[model samples]
Target chain A: MSHVNGLPKKSPDMNGNVTITDCGDSALVAKAVGLDAEAAWRLVHALADALDAVRLTGGHDVVPTYDALLVEFDCTSTDHATVRSVLAHEAARLGPHPEPITPPRHFVVPVVYGGEYGPDLPEVAAQLGLSEGEVVELHSGSDLTVRCLGAPAGAPMTDGPPFPKPVPRLASPRTRVDPGSVAAAGRQAVICPMPSPGGWPLLGRTPVRILDLHSDPITAYQPGDTFRFRPITPQQWDEYADLSLADLVDSAGLANSADLVDHHG
Target chain B: MADTLTIRTAGIVTVQDLGRVGRSRYGLPANGAADQHSARVANVLCGNDERAPLLEITALDFACVPSSDILIAVTGAPADVTVEGGVRPQWEPVPVRAGETVKVSGIRQGLRVYLAVLGSFEADRLQGSCAPDTILGFGPALSTGDELVLRTACPPLDHPFSRIPLFRLKAPVPPFPTSWTIDVTDGPDRAEFGDTGRRLFDAPFTVTPRSNHIGLRLQGEVPRRVTKGEVLSRGVPIGAVEVPAGDELLVLHRGRGVTAGYPVLAVVTATGLSALGQVRPGQTISFRHRTLDQAVAAHRAQRNAIDALRSRVRTAFDALRIRAPAGT
Candidate 1:
């Protein structure tokens, strides 16, 4: 492993450490090794900010995941060696250990739990040896941080405090999980942005449209954003479901009134 | 009003360009033509921009009738093109007169074919690209009787065959080996597989029928992993060769999902990726290890060759007094 400036290079197996590796001729993957949910969030955000600082230097893309960031560059314009050296220089500038200074953006996402919207709620409760109401309380109670945006367009994979017992994946994946279905597997929680085949246990369905093609930013949730599910009735879901992109932008606290006009127009 | 081309027999036809870049961060897949090399060649042959919208036809049995004169070229899979019962060769520009029906059939040796027209196709653009994302329902797929509107009008040529000599330049076609051997470099998770990773190049693997634009699933000997645990889901590149729990090898293609959970043992080179695009089901393929420097060199060489072909096409057009369609 190459050292980042004067900082000591940590091995891949070391916990809470960051390591960089060559993915191919055009990309490099910098992974935060063995980090928990909170640490992963910090590292991902820090790495994303650092990569953004050097955005103009021919880095085509910077994708932040659960605990890693993949930086892709055009080999014709900028070679791998230049990208590596730039990243190293940035790492050194940020110092050996960088802290997340920006406060995480927060949101109160409304969800309708159980019934037709979530068929696997009762089964998930039974598996965890808890009442149906208890499952809902535990699921919606904790603050979840968006660890990554993936699996599909605008899909947010969030991580929260672990439940008393780990939630297991379904034996057979469903043919299609409805869009906005909130599901949990093991300790990870994810909101299905679009209808897709999924294996996770459904806990509820959110009314917020996470992905809107017409929207300027497209995705509502970014990495490091925190959200907690607020239980709403099925009637409320119907009301919010009819909300337009402008209304969603208002409710999600995405932009100010001035920017809303531009997005709406 | 712009002239339109109506599809008579459509078989999995969709519009594709160079794809939406810098959008993967939003979990969007970088969807484009499956065989980019062939697509570029087709565009060059018809004198369109390299990233112009074109049709990517799979298992092609496609026929289209133009309302007016148009310049068209078909590349990849070596298909037979006929314009009004007259044979037209592949990899060369062919001009069809008004109300002429062009039929393409007998696609052999490969799976997909790229058809490029003179001007850009008037299609819906999502994120500044015409490439269809089948999973996301972003663009329209061609069907029988559907008219493909052209952005620019093509007036009838007094002598359509006059420019045939100008397009006689030989296009450099990439070799599609009968028994394919793809070149790959080490992936991020190579260390996790240890000796099993080295064994990936030892035997040939068969492409399974389950493969599609998403990925090329291959049946091969499962590589043993020294570590057994889930790595955090991360961004996966286009040519990543991921090995999931089932021991099957999946080479992610142009329409690959933005992220994957499987351990990636290797990544196919850019040239190897275009070659992978031509591989049909049931075909056997083997992997050959290549260094990063070598992969870079090979990619540069392929780009240089394409550049050379572009210049030759330009020279021919200039000499023949045939102006390429504007904004190409």
Candidate 2:
């Protein structure tokens, strides 16, 4: 088989591979061919990076999702054909296998499970045929990767390893889910960075402020980050509650205090 | 700086500009003026930058008292504009004296209206946009007793009310068709619906009350999809007509989330999206398929029309020795 950059070049017949298509007059979509979460993430990152390089010349934005990367450009200045050509050139440079521009960051998020913080915990556990404690163990014990930030600003969709049985979304969506609520739907887990209506089943609430508008880097988790839930007591949740973005960053130790300087500075 | 405008009866008003561009990657929706055409027109009438922040008022009544002499224009939904009890024409630039209360009510058509001043509104901005994204909890919604501050000082102009030229153009008037015919093109998931996708053009859909800036939920037969598997969540552009399992057609709008899981049957063309923005609840809508080239041409034409109008306004301003704000 022909190989480029140590990764096998996707054949046309491959069930789940990347294919580029026109999304609209000013946008193009590169969709991941299959249902595999890992493959989807890899393709999304690869295409997003390729498009980012292309955007150096012209392009408004490139949004990466679980299974696709949407590239938007100014139609008046650059046409879809030009963007496609740029993508093709970038693909040649990537050579099938492309390394992530930045190494994945890891986070340990402390979550308070059950009770008011997690209103749907018992229901989700019952549907999964597991005890409430077992449900918590299953969710927190597994390491998950940040698929992408979506649904709302700073809301991170994390891909958990396949569950023993498929989990379903809530038939009736709640009008509001509290901010910092940890929720699960199907095979994916998500952190509600803001209070918004959604169909995902609430599993817990984290004290971490994932979507801090006051912060320099508005979100806590970025794509390609690894995270695991650490069960915390309600008291611990209270202790961490009301912490500012600067405080959270300090606790995470990911960025230096100097990096927390305001935009005006 | 110019004195702030005091809100006397603040309806559902929020500051909006051209929207936050290039922030979809951070899961931020492009929340801007629901009707960009009207917003741009209002700004042009006021001699402000096209993307300057303006008040987006919903169906409810809005009343404000200016603290300084200001030039203003109201566009979008047809509404009665009364300046100190004197009726002023909608979609035309009108000058108001300081302390004169301007009341906008009796909306005849459309759902929202744009109110633009001669200069941009001073407000907290996120991602270079003043538009409020309630989901993200950024930017404030205008309320009774709130004050609206302007970015620039406005010195009273010495122009007579009779001499202020009204640059009239063929703009769409509302009592917006009870039934709307919108144009659309194939979406990324168009093939997922197979032959059933053709049904989209055959029937009319009613806009349900359970709709907001996020999307318009249509009451109609859900176009059937042959692919029975879960669609991975992906980026959804504005004007994407998605069909969830509930058998309702949901057309994403300006405030749509960054990503969605429903299968998108078609994407409304740029002109179609502007038309969709004016649709009121209980309105009936039908879709017509257009080729990609046709959609592009229509978008270009609409943009060119706006540019021509802007040029005319600029020429009028130059002739009258009126100073307009710089480019957006």
Candidate 3:
């Protein structure tokens, strides 16, 4: 990691680096290279926070991937040099643990475990030497940070529980994992909001709709948001059939209540 | 009475526009039309705003009849456009009488064609875009017998023979080429393929028939990885030239997801993407190296040409006292 202008940065930004690259003429990326998952996540969020604090005309998105921050803009209105310069300025200002774009929200996602919902549940449990109940208990009891949200859009990528051993990826990935599939690999967990090809072991399926393309901010679980998976029996699945991630987030009972104001949470 | 266009013979059709913006953070691709250049030209020629939804016709016969007389534009590809057996030219807006079927068939030289009615065509919209997610088969997939209601009953021109000379003065785009030369810049994972890296530019690639809106699969000299490592799944831009394990070089199109783990050796320029969008199956493409600045300049040139046309049309509309259709 290279220091920005040789200035000392506190905590997350300390020893963290960002290498900005141009993807064609339309998109720009600020990648955090040679960092672990947690460190990369922090550095990316910091950069994102710094950039989002200001208003940029012609900018389309500030998408946070697992280890990179992608900023897309309308090239007709802005040039790559202008956008890259702004990115560098914003990145240089990320001195420490930066804030989030919006106040962090919490959600309790209800999921149904095993059998048809999770074909790999039995194999995963056997490999981990934990019973199905124990696996569910350990996974549902842990709190996870929404590390990133991307791929097919609005899919929440978060942290899984500390298992005795890291879960291995599937030998052959599924051609299409249906939406709302709760999957886990190593210490990471992901909720598929859209049907996509995935290698992570499917632990369960959630009834709640995590992404609605028609709505802005498609998913409630942005980076820095907190969520906990609560296991449910198959019989109670229909109870949350029509619920969405927003429905639960709006009821988070935060200080601002329903308003998505910045509360530094 | 609702102005409608009833499909007589439908091919693979979908509604497209300039595409959705400010939705990528949610993983939504900037999917509007596969060939934005043609789509914009079609919309602007018919005096519709650039964002107005139009039909993107692929590889089959497509015919529709408007409930009322309206002006329409056909652009992209070298498809034959005919109105009630009379041949009409592409690129320039032409007046179509009510009940006369406008048919686009015999598309031999290209992959896609854009059809824009003068008024707004009602289609399923998601996040303010009519462009469907072709990968997931989500959104409106137009088919035979489907009647698309035009929200605004646009007043037709005097007659087909009374075509506006100003719009007609614009010539049709040149015929699609059998061979394409695309410009590309080095990608993030360009170093992955060592010796074979140069093969990407040196050899020619053929666009395979298995291609779709998501990506164009190509058959060419496979750039086998010299050293293999798990490439981190990072956010990718459109026009990425990915090397999959199966030896097929995949050039991602507009419908691809925002993030991917595949090794991207090069990224096609904006102008290259537009050209690739029109490439028919079995057509050859040769990649040429370009600096980032050159790529941007080329794209800007292409966009500037369209912008100039847009302004000219705006002035033409003012002179003709034409108003945009409703529900734009």
Candidate 4:
């Protein structure tokens, strides 16, 4: 990458595996830039700024999308072909992606399996021909990556250890899933943040409320943060009923209090 | 400080400005005037900035007494407005005498109305905005018998009667046929839908009764998700149309979720957004796709017209010879 006015210039190598995606009307997104979420994030912000400059100079209304910079032009003011040319030119000269930023903390979520909390536990266990305990062992043993946040703030989007048959959700979704329920959809896993309608196969519940709306940092997990799950008994889940979901996630053991150290704290 | 308005009956009123902007990142929806265009015009008529805080009255029956005489304007949804039992226009300025009661009663057509006072009103700003989001329980919605003190300068003119410039245009009614067109853009998940789903977007879809601030439950061709790529939850602004379960579309409005999990089908343009804003339950809506360039132009053009009309009103008001009484 070369520098123009001390700013990093976009290089041809940026095209490989790093494809730009459009999020909304005003956003352009650079995705799949390896696992460096921060690098892609910086590039997105810079491209947004560059596109904003172009809009201002051209007297157009352009906005940055979630992943892509949406370039809006006034048809009455300028031709579409001309605007496309300018976008192409900017995309070519834009700076390379920035260095990745590591998350401040990693969280290990512990979930209780079977019984009332996980209604689908028997079905999943029977399908796999494994005891409920073995299923929980497999689930809690794997390292789950933090894909992204969802509905409730800081709620994790996890690639699952794959349950048998990936049980189809309820014909009709439950009006409200109890917060802390560990749910599975297809091959993915999700920790419910608040009481919301969901159709996922719930394995068990955790005690953590990962999303704190009132707090300065709304969510605990950002992209690139690592997560692991551990199995806790339904009795253990009830023991720490009053404790938060953040407090129950453990790297090891049913309730390793030391592992529950608050990262924000 | 100017004299305040004594809310003899608050009647579901809340203080509003042009909802809190630049705070969407914090997961807070900007809960401002429901009818923003009407609110802007009302503020401009009273020589206040368009962003000034005002009383947004829902379903009327709100009455207030000005502590000191001052100028005020009301807009949005037709309501029977009067000061001391005298009738006044729904969308213009009127003078109120100090200690005299001003009342707005019965929503005739619209759902929400804006009441603006000169030099703004006395309100506690939360999260850099006086607008209240009832969903979050941040600010209190005005109830009956609530008194509001105005933190404004200058009492009413000695004469106490000011002629407000009248530029009357009837607010657009919904279920518009033939001429009414709502502009939408290609959705992020547009390609995910089959021909039938695509045709539904190309055709008109009826807005179902299940629509609200949360989202619009549309009755249209169901969109099929062919490829099952995991859609990451991300920020979805007002006017995003998503198809989650089937062919029916869920269109988001002003009080939309800051983030969503569904694949977006279309993003409505500003003009299309205006129609969506006024859409009540059971209204039929059709999507007209426009190029991104056209959407931006339409927004700018609409603003220009509104601004021009405001200037004309200001000029007419300035031309009128309403002089203050001689001071001793």
Which one wins on DockQ? 2
By summed lDDT, the worst window of 10 consecutive residues in model 4 chain B runs over B319-328
- Clash counts for all predictions: 0, 2, 2, 25
Give me the displacement of residue B110 in model 2, in angstroms.
0.7
DockQ of each: 0.52, 0.54, 0.45, 0.18
User: Better model by DockQ, 2 or 3?
Assistant: 2
Displacement of the residue B307 alpha carbon in candidate 1, Å: 0.8
lDDT (10s digit) by residue, model 2, range B78-174: 7888989988878777777889899999765578888888876677888788888989878778889998886554555535556443445443333
Quality class of the docking in candidate 3, CAPRI style? acceptable
* Weakest lDDT window of 10 consecutive positions for candidate 2 chain A: A256-265
Q: List the global CA lDDT of all models.
A: 0.76, 0.76, 0.76, 0.60
Model 2 CA RMSD to the hidden true structure, in angstroms: 5.8
* Reference-based lDDT, residue A107, model 1: 68
Q: In candidate 4, what are the lDDT values of residues A1-265, reduced to their tens digit?
A: 1222232222212443245443333433343345344344445445545656654333233322234333433333443344444444455566455333342344667677778888878877776687888778767876665544444433566666656645455566676678888877655677877666677778888876666545544565554355677677766766666655455344443344234223211
How does candidate 4 fare on TM-score?
A: 0.72
